[model samples]
Target: MKITHYCLSALLLFAVAGCDRLEQDMLSVPDDTTLDRYGLDTLKLGDKRAEVGKQLDALLDKPMQCTPGKTGLGDKRKAYLLEECSGVPVAGEVGKLWGEKLSFFKAVFVEDQLCSLELQLKTSGDYAALYEAHGKKIINLFGKPDEANAKGVRWQREGDEAVLKDLGDGNISFEIRNKKVVQALHHKG
Candidate 1:
């Protein structure tokens, strides 16, 4: 009886310890190159609309309403916009990307899955400087862009693509898209 009791206690202790380690591993930050190709912190390219909404609920001034005909890609997209919602303030990993300069953020869903994320950054007189600063940060995370030019930079990996461009209107546009979803939309149209 004593041996059985001691063995059970030891097994329970080992199980608890293992669970702790697993939890820590799950919560730890991912490596720079392992952000699942293209994601804005917690928001990923293929997340469901409900999950994305739950994650961003605090930063949104009001509940995001899915609107039609906003994507201009086709009639099958539903878009949620945070236009001028910068007043609400953002925090965490998503906020660190562009910080207070972020003027707009849009998430487009195809068949209830997030297909794209678009962000607009409002700049002052020195758009170039702002673009360079943000560009460097993106490069550090995703490495050298596959395509680069005076106006923009693009990085493609697997089925995902990230583009950062100078809008030439005191704004910078950064977009991340899932190629498969986008291609399907175009094909349907």
Candidate 2:
């Protein structure tokens, strides 16, 4: 009976120690490889427009093409289009054909802060294929998306978000934004 009690006590102590180690490992923060590094160039979430605009100017060696304005498209937020800039990074064969064929992009702002950036591709053939392939590539680079549907795929990390959408008629749009802004838009709708 004494040996049995000793053995049970020892087992209980080992189990408690093992659980503590597991808990500590689970609570520790991951490295910088996640969505934290997933913004457009230096334009990240929570950045003011003036600072981001300066960074954009430094990249383009010129000023933004358009001032921020409301789109009346339901979001009620303003936007700026950064035209013909070395902006977003493309994926797969589609990326190779982007600038040479057709490419356009915009940076979205709300209250003088960059909340989102958008990239679009206009092509006649294989648009669906390219969009699907790009979505898969985003998954590979940023892990599995947070929300996915027939319309689009979204990935989020620590309140920042990224999305790829099929705009139909051979057009695809990719947007990344701050989580607060995304939540606000969703709430508005």
Candidate 3:
């Protein structure tokens, strides 16, 4: 009857409105917390070598050594290494990446633009325990990783990627890279 038709129309209208709201929420960009979770706010990928050098100089205990060579990907790259910069904090505001200590930090630049960052966590004993704990912490912050296995976990966003790998020793390697830049370089050659 007439009442049934009216009810059906009203329900359809409400459903459409709800779907629009949901779509908007899903499309919304992530906030600053996302950037902080991956240390992108400070050591952002795709930055120039000089810019990164200034940031590293402020955080590291001493100057890192830069070596020029070709990367495994066959791109001309510059790799910077800080071997003994333990306990040096890098991430802004959050500090020390959930209080885990670091043994070394590295930055790799392709064509003078930074493409990746690598950090090794320092631990005395129980490497697996520390790795599991850090993985849980990262999952809590960034949700489930895109890929995970016994040795590593990776989370990839639109233009960047973050990875946590178990080195089978008393350390874990955490790395972040710019996927867009890497893909572009690969295509160029």
Candidate 4:
């Protein structure tokens, strides 16, 4: 199913805990991995990494997950570290897109059953409108990307099993979920 910007925003989440799924992966650490990485003085109900990933999993079950950072929409700047890797446009790397300059917003991850990755972004305009132009191809190199070539719709990329969705908004968020790309239900907001 096709993923829309509005649908992508709802699942935007910040990673803060360690889930069991990480155990299978080499990067998977202990339950307190998040605390070690980000330094958590206090843990809240929603502050658990594993739990957060689970909640985010349900949120992003289709459309994949996109980590879009740094936007020029209207007149704001943002950056997403993890999500930033995908929006660069060169297939890999995030910094400058040849002749294009940009800032970053937030980084979010959208996953699927197979654990594929998709980065989502909400952008307006950038230095060269670089993102305003070829953002999908950039995200395409990250994972599964779909180019939303429709006018006024922005862009999107679907990788082997993941997808990066551009909502055309101005905020980007990523969450860890058991599955990736949550299916879209409606097109219009």
Count of backbone clashes, every candidate in sequence:
0, 0, 0, 51
Better of 3 and 4 by lDDT: 3
Q: Which candidate leads the pack in lDDT? A: 1
Q: Superposing every Cα of model 3 onto the true structure, what RMSD results?
A: 13.9
Best by TM-score: 1
The regions of model 2 sitting more than 4 angstroms off are: 1-33, 41-43, 47-63, 68-104, 110-113, 127-137, 182-189
Tens digits of lDDT, candidate 1, 40-141 = 656777787777766655444444445543332444464432121122334422232345355666677765677787777656635334423443344445
lDDT (C-alpha, whole model) for all candidates: 0.53, 0.48, 0.52, 0.27
Order of candidate numbers by TM-score, starting with the best = 1, 3, 2, 4
Off by over 4 Å in 4: 1-114, 122-124, 132-147, 151-159, 171-189
Error of 4 at 97 (Å): 13
lDDT of 2: 0.48
Order candidates by lDDT, high to low: 1, 3, 2, 4
The C-alpha RMSD in Å for every predicted model, in order, reads 17.0, 15.0, 13.9, 18.7
Whole-model lDDT, model 4: 0.27
What TM-score would every model get versus the actual structure? Answer: 0.57, 0.47, 0.51, 0.21
Writing each residue's lDDT as its tens digit, candidate 4 over 63-143 gives 223543332222224321222222333332233213332223122332212222233343333312434244333332222
